[model samples]
Target chain A: MSKYAELFATESRDHLTAMEHALLELESAPADRSALDALFRSVHTLKGMGGAMGYGTVSTLSHAMESLLDRVRSGQESLTPPSIETLLQATDALASAVAASTTGRESALDISTLLTRLAVPAAPAQGTTRVLQIVLDPGTPLPGARAQLIVGRLARVAEIVRVEPDVAGMESAQFTGEFTVQLRSAEAIEVLGDAARAAGFVSSLVEVVPRDEVRQTPLSVDATWNTGDLQAPLQKYVRIESRRLDGLMDLVGELVTMRDRLQVVASRHGDPALDEAVAKAGRLIGELQDGVIGSRLVPVWQVFDRFPRVVREAARAAGKEAVLVVEGREIELDRSLLEQVADPLVHLLRNAVDHGIEPADARVRGGKAVEGRVLLMARRERNSVVVVVADDGRGVDRQRVLAKARRLGWVTDDTEMLSDDEVLRIIARPGFSTAEQVSEVSGRGVGIDAVLAKVRGLGGAVEFSSVEGKGTVFQLRLPVTLAIIPAIIAQVGAESYALPLTHISETVQPAAGALRRVQGRPVFVLRGQVLPLYSLRALVGAAGRDPEGQQIVIVEATDRRAAVLVDRLVGQQDIVVKSFDLVRGMSAGFSGAAILPDGTAALILDAGGLL
Target chain B: MSRQLLVVSVAETLYALPSELVREITTLPSQVTRLPGAEPSIRGLINVRGQLFPVMDLCHRLRGVPGNEAVDVLVVVSDGKTLGLLVDDVRDVIPMDEPAASVTAPDEADTSVVRGVGHSGEMVVIELDVPKLVRSSLA
Candidate 1:
């Protein structure tokens, strides 16, 4: 048994119990964010430890289950009763795997079908579609063939969505020159027309009328936030106790509230200097909060730089020559998150050296470089940090994995070939390597399941792509969802509502007639950006306690933004968010609840759902 | 063994809840933040000692009597989840024969949440299944 096996097993048992507890809690309150988060954290930590301890089957199973959970956290999928049952069964299988892995062996349990059940299929492509009507000269020869040629020409610039009467109908004797084609693309109408006419058939007008978007004017309201890069290595502090920092944050939160009240008082006084000072204090407070919060998050390099040393030792152990390459070292993650990921990352690096890289003699026979190249890179992608662990070595043996999967009744007899993703699923099955020497020869099946699970628990994902005898690339993607931050509390009706300050582009009190009716829907044009206006009165239906002034908060999420009109602005404050049970009936737009300084609970709005 | 029950009034009808199941009883605050899209029987939520508890109006929940503001709240626990049951008043805590007081009232027509209707001479109290009540209505 490995030196870390006992420690890993003990920790894993506790996490498993916690995960089951969270799962049971979820069964009661399906929308409990804290429960879901706890469940994800436990799964993630276990996967990391399992990988670090060199337990392949443990990691594999953990990864499969984590993918399902990641989908649920990102709102890409939901937790149904059946899925919950599958998860419970997965927990039991994982517990047994943990027990078996302590002895350096895979669990003799076949859960490939269960793993398959956990997979969330990819979403289809979304693009603006347009319909083109082409009328050719009445006496044109081979009109159908001409249409087909035009479609093929247009395919270079646009996706050929559909053609009227289908391909067979276009080639039929009953075909007409006026058949319509639906094309989805980002090209200009003139470009599409030219491509259609380039086929050289006489035509009436080659105009493509766009489908569905002509009635309303286009709105450009997606005000994306730019979290600027971490500046120079200044004297930001080597280390500080997190509890003390939390205390400092609380004091700052109070200062922010004081600033809000001060602004109101200063503005009422009509003194420019006082107002300027108050505004400056607000800006300073915002910066201070961001800095303290950012300080709590350590850069990826803190943990990543240690991996090269791990790879060096691993390569030596495997009798292989390997070089480790690291990039995007400055990407920041919550310190605890970075710590949890380090162990799994080490396992992946070692696995690459011991299993992925070929022996020196084998490398020469394969006509490849003497030293295997391993890359550990991190890049921020929208709301996630994608950390890729790729290696230039012999890829996974798909044939062997598929055959094993079939024998385990994971895939049917007719299953012939497997995609890179399918190969991952097969390798992650708890019993994939239980057949002893089969796993030892196949390469790259060790500790992968647990690594996958841990990332999923963090509401992240692992994407696999490989080529036979070439190499394998594994991308671990994790969400950088906000934990604690400043929020703008707006009074809507009789309640105070908190919106994450990051999601809001700006707040404005529109001039009279600025909020116009476009097709009977209220919209506001702000500095040339069109934003849809949603009335808080109409949305929440809480009776207003006498209006003071209406304020519109421009909230943005992904590619959508909208103006939420509230009773008035209650100013900005740094809210200390505590993990609380999800109040199921608190409505769809609300993400969770927080207690305000005045001792009343306020619902925190989810910007994504609001838009 | 004797079963101890805390008797309370909801729209003037006497009901008994097992004393062990009751966490504590407190006066219902006048103001409650309305939870949007919640069931009609839910009289919104109240923050008691920083912990928010959804208040269930027993008057409307049980008897279909709408819009009655309950005076007292019976804070209760069911399956680790806590809720405040709004009632008009808490009459008393009385003890009765364990099995005898738990028998189905002979004249009772329906048993939706009523476990039994117990009687002591002319005094009667309807014992409710707390878990059943939470499951059937709160959700």
Candidate 2:
């Protein structure tokens, strides 16, 4: 496909997302006029774009949606729930059509069901009229002829019910460059605009007064108003393909590394001019890196926007009434992280609706409100974002969970009262579900474990708190970005390793007597807690014993805390993580490699693996 | 199309990697950070121009005798990653007029590393299969 076609596909997907959000908003607030206008404009632009790209199916479907939206905008038709669903389904079809176009394949999706739904008959013409004010380019050689051509084009799309200055006067070539052509068409304003543009030499299109709005206030037909300010999206931001943004970020990372190298060289030479130049470059590089990384951040609402619909469907299927309240949607996260976390968040929300929420009759019997509430909130903490999915319904039954754990042989009878940590661990084990019967939505014994694995893979953690009668709140703490992170470099043997500081609690110089043995396993008592101790040297298969004065770095994974013994603690620094292909025979202990300031490679240890 | 190859030796075996894949050649660096849990064939990681990449010990990878003498590092690109291959010594770069066809190897290990065997007159040069070697090293 041509580059332009590729660009159209990307832009069309963005537009589709906007349309979906607007349609959802319209469903919640049927009388929201601004949302209706935005929805109409999105479909209008999509139609034009698809038509230009020769995507006949997408354009045709969008055109049908625009017509129905026109009726709703004019107050001739109302937006029902079924109508909203039809519009959403149509948008999905358009998205697939856009994808097909990118691959140079004709869209074979049968959108006839959607097209029939969107083909709502237009209201009869009731004398309401739209005054379209068209201005021709001043540089056109023959302004009068251009006006005639435009009027002829407008006549083809709509009825030329009223032409200012008289049709005979226009034919006589006595008018200026601009003329007001009053149109009376049941078609949306977008169709008329297309027709006007199809005629040459038009510079501007103003929907001076829509048909329904003009009905309320009678203005002189000759009096024209500029309504071009009502355009959607306002052209305030430029749309850039994310791949180009990634390329920019990669270049910035390379620049930062080069700047570090320059700083090292400058310090050695002790040249004042060189030092000044290097310092300036360093500051500029820092600012550029921030800007590049900032551009890659998008509001979390992009993912949160789809949850309300998910909750509605899941609640309906489960025979319950649940309301999803989303907060902190404006919080921004790395775009790639947002995409990665979307599915996991959806699964958690489904788990809440499917399992945590009780049916309506059961809720009243349990002395709770009939409607269940699921609150999805995101907030920033230090260097990570914590998203919590809290449901106020039937909380987890600890007894049932313990019984299931016993049945699965995950814990023996000797296991004491299971703490919340132990409970979370058991739930996170694959194929460990307390659900009595597998439901279609979730809880097939495959969800929570997958959620744990995915979150951990992205350098995040998940935990939950449940009260017998109150509710359950699942919290996911995730790093803001993955490219660059602060890591504590430590020596395992003769080799240096970097550990993500997100998981490190502290480094302690353990006294000799602090060491103890529990069940033939090494353990260290820190602050009266017997923390499992593992030597990094032994874990990495290194030779020799750890030197005296070795420090135990306490690290936290999911629900467990452990101490990793290292020879020495190197100071912390922000390092760029570079991914490499791990050979088949290699161990999976290390996450990836990082380049230290001294121009050497340090394997960044995966903190979870240490546990 | 004519192609250039960089010939290097590990122990007594001769190997050649396509020159396009070889980014540069430098004397082994003094500080090669050893990755303790990495595959035995991966000697360590060497930092080149602020970028750190895994260095594979060709002698061990090719199942040849370990050489104690100084080795030169051949930094090459494979699967979009930069890797350094340590060889006993660097030989001359030779041009081949046409593509070399594969010859049946005496064993599976030799076939896995050698894409084809090229004859530079009487000297037999084992053409290194760069992608397969890197994939196996990472695997």
Candidate 3:
């Protein structure tokens, strides 16, 4: 990896995230000044960083976005839904530019079209009443011709409503270094300010003044207001790379591991002097790790902050009326997991908007509120984060799923013997689409499978449940962090393996008499329910005859539990996971390999891989 | 008109695989893991030092009698990673001059086991095709 690649990755990711959040805010309260300001700041920072990093295309595009936002923020222009659309497009272009920069490829960011759209005059009805305010620092000597040119450029956007030191008044007295203008135009205030700055003015100030204050009803026409004034100082925020945070996390992981090892050694030796030292060290490391990891725990709000815009656009596209309610957005997760989970979460939210929510008329006919409600919730679970997307509208039609499965030959006479969970699994399969028609937003049968695959790929699990005529709920459970995990070490035949402890529901030696044959598969009665048993030796391709008897490790994959029989239980140990590329055409029953305490290599079994 | 060859024995036949393909020679482990549902030639995954690698039994792959004894030497060749190939023994690497035209195998000869026959004076060197041998064993 290049020395700066990680920095670029982290910085660009943060910029994208901030841009997403800001766009979402803009979609809802389009007139919210603070939201516009935040969006402008994010764009401005991205442009600055991109320029510093020699990503010229990204810098230029973001610079255009910054200029547009400046206009919107200054009240020189009003934010329309179309403008928000343009802003979202610009955000996408910025993301592409960043992607190109990181990959060392030149990106052609054709942002001129979007910039032109943004520059288009605001709708006649929503135009802002322009105010021209000018302030010049006493330190600069302003040549007369340049000042005149500055004043002339401002006149194009709004009427030259006011010019300090009227031509007759200027002859008698030197200009007092500052002036203000009260004019009427719906354009954003920052446009005028940027125009002044560009015109070689030493300082410029611009703000929207009320039409009533101007005591004039401005005609709904394109006009410019010239107010020769100095602009106020812009607010600035610093951006940092996430790798620095990750580096800190790495140190924290090492500290925690060392602390655990020290505790083990101290307890085993039981020396009083060493006991005190280890105790102090353990406390210090615990605090340090928590502090470091806590620094990387970003609130779920970062993800949820983008849903309002998605719901709005999706609802509009689908001819539906929907309200998005987000709760527990303050719940924080590891920053890395947050990034991976964001896309899938957005997809789920979009699905809820496009498919789960019914049209206002349909909803009313169903005795529901005209507006559909989609709720996004995040919460901390034991060592994991649970993110839920739920909608209050027409729920999934199980009959349709069953019909489709039957038509696809996925269901048979024997499938009638399968439970509802098994039927749902079929629907989740790749290429399974029940929608009668595809929509622009979703229903291509692509994203859901990707969502499932990604969640599983990240070692997380997704659960779906729907109540007909009510709504659908998708619950995603993800590990709090991916850097480390608690795993159980067990011996399969002669080789030892580590299985993620999260998947292990419990381990018990099934009574020899309790084993029963169910559909030609060996199963054991656990709590009065039959659980399938798989031989670890057979799964791992071990040699020799199967052991006469073995211990069973019952593991859970979503709602299903399976008993994995191994020759011996070697007890549990937390092993650091190491990834290896799967050989082409290799389908061995393991996810990756890890090093054991004795430095022997052992495969780490994937619970989901078994499925 | 001229040829160079190295001959090795599998069962009673003399086979020649190009010297360029012979990567290295080493002793194989006494015990081998048997992957169920895998081909007979695949001795299964093995731990070589601290790394996991796969070992293939050449005799079984070549359709010779599968040896029950621990392999005395292992020929490690790279097909990506170092694959351990169990061989009976290494014969001398002898240079040869071209004799008559190469001949096709007879019905009794395992065509799948031999690529072609090279003649050098009174000795005939049967060329071993590793991929074909592996495929036939796997099939």
Writing each residue's lDDT as its tens digit, candidate 1 over A43-137 gives 88888777776688778878987888999899876664445656776777777777666755464545566567667432213476766677777
C-alpha lDDT of residue A19 in model 2? 94
lDDT per residue for candidate 2 within B1-139, as digits (tens), equals 6579888987766778889998899877788877666767787777776567778888777764444564798988887877788898999898754436557445434467678877676777888889888877765
lDDT by residue (A145-238, candidate 2, tens digit) is 7788888988897888777767566656566676788777766555777898898788876655343653454323212212221122223346
What does the i-RMS of model 2 come to? 2.4
Higher-ranked by TM-score: 2 or 3: 2
| lDDT-sorted candidate list, best first | 2, 1, 3
Q: Give stretches of model 1 more than 4 Å off.
A: A1-484, A544-548, A578-586, B66-69, B96-111, B120-122, B137-139
Residue B51, candidate 1: how far off, in angstroms?
Answer: 1.6
| CAPRI-style quality class for the chain A–B interface of candidate 1 | incorrect
The regions of model 2 sitting more than 4 angstroms off are A1-235, A255-285, A443-445, B1-7, B17-29, B48-52, B67-83, B88-111, B115-121
TM-score for the first chain of model 2?
A: 0.66
Interface RMSD values for all candidates: 3.5, 2.4, 6.1
Q: Is the docking of candidate 2 incorrect, acceptable, medium or high quality?
A: acceptable
Candidate closest to the true structure, highest lDDT: 2
- The TM-score that candidate 1 achieves is 0.44
TM-score list, all predictions: 0.44, 0.68, 0.55
